[model samples]
Target: MDNQHVDAWKDMIYPALISKKEELEMLGYEQATPEDVWKCLSVKVWKGEPEKRLHEMVQDIFHLKSSVYLSYLTIQSYENDDLAASVEALLGNTENKES
Candidate 1:
């Protein structure tokens, strides 16, 4: 995949994985790698058809509960300015409202 799509994947998935760190540790995966967390979160997000679910998630990031700044930070951590810009463009003009 291209960098833009890879960035979108990281932008959507990494935060969810990070948020599960404590949970994964509590479940005896104290040494969990990013790949491990990715697997775990992917399973939790969709028990079946993960690739399809992930595609849907990429489309849904705009509707995520996370603040725009937080999302930007997550994308920036991966050094994907293009994805960060895409995220900002999607969120910049919107009112802060939870769904």
Candidate 2:
């Protein structure tokens, strides 16, 4: 789906996202945000799916399991951490060679 279609649902689904985020917060994910909840859904639950119905999207948000969200976060952290590590290693090498 195009971004325009998704963007149209942002306002409509934001409350659901916030509610989901709050649920996450109560479960110890205190830093959770609507954006994070949305990302969790989009990347993990809706990955590679074509065209999501509004009810389907809402149900996915409401029914989202903590385990799934946590798994997504863990995977994302590892992927991101790997990139940061690689950049730091490269910069370290450059600085060492300069010295």
Candidate 3:
């Protein structure tokens, strides 16, 4: 994946991990280290394309309540930005065609 996609993935995962750390530990991951958790989650994200991974992350965050809605908001913001860019591109193409 590109750096931008990797960075966006990090932005989603890090906050969720930080907020869910205690819960994860309580759920039988107590012996696992931070890097271990990171590696596990990173692999899950890497298994899919960037957008699919992001959607899965957002759903996980919503269900996990990992960051108490923070992670969900972060992903939603990114989705909204993507939507806006798509809309702008479509509009620009239409204008160019008209011109």
Candidate 4:
């Protein structure tokens, strides 16, 4: 994939994975073990497709929306500058204002 698609993938996949990781941590996992976490997430992402499940797992869990979008970005990167910035800004604002 091209740099833009790679960035898009980073934007979407990181948040989702981080969200899921937080959820899992809240459930008392203590720490994020790649095998356990990835396995659980893979199951959720693939939705029981045996053949294409692995590929789908990575794509769904890490690709965000679809690889097709990445392919599009590969050709001519997306233009959503503010799409993922809000979350970071919110976190930053919260940290600065925290007690």
User: Among these predicted structures, which one has the highest TM-score?
Assistant: 2
- Predictions in order: lDDT: 0.49, 0.84, 0.55, 0.46
lDDT for 46 in candidate 3 is 40
Q: What is the lDDT of candidate 4?
A: 0.46
Give candidate 4 misplaced runs (Cα > 4 Å).
1-11, 33-36, 43-99
Q: For residues 1-99, what per-residue lDDT tens digits would candidate 2 score against the true structure?
A: 333344457788888999999999999999888998888887887776546667767788999999998998999899999999999999999999999
Model 4 C-alpha RMSD vs. true structure (Å) is: 15.4
What local lDDT score does residue 26 receive in model 3, on the 0 to 100 scale?
65
lDDT tens readout by residue for model 3, 1-99: 333344367555666656565566665546434444454444443444344455566445435533433343456579899999999999999999999
Of 1 and 4, the candidate ahead on TM-score is 1
Error of 3 at 93 (Å): 66
Across residues 26-53, which tens digit of lDDT does each residue of candidate 4 receive? Answer: 6554564434344444344344534433
TM value for model 2: 0.86
TM-score of 4: 0.29
lDDT of 1 by residue, 35-96 (tens): 54444334334355334445555444323333432343455457677878888877875645
| TM-score pick, better of 1 and 2 | 2
| Cα misplacement distance, residue 58 of candidate 2 (Å) | 0.8
**Model 1 regions lying over 4 Å from their true place:** 1-7, 39-99
Report the number of the highest-lDDT candidate: 2
Which one wins by lDDT: 2 or 4? 2
Q: Using lDDT as the measure, name the better of candidate 3 and candidate 4.
A: 3
Candidates arranged by lDDT, highest first: 2, 3, 1, 4
- Candidate 3: RMSD over Cα atoms? 13.9
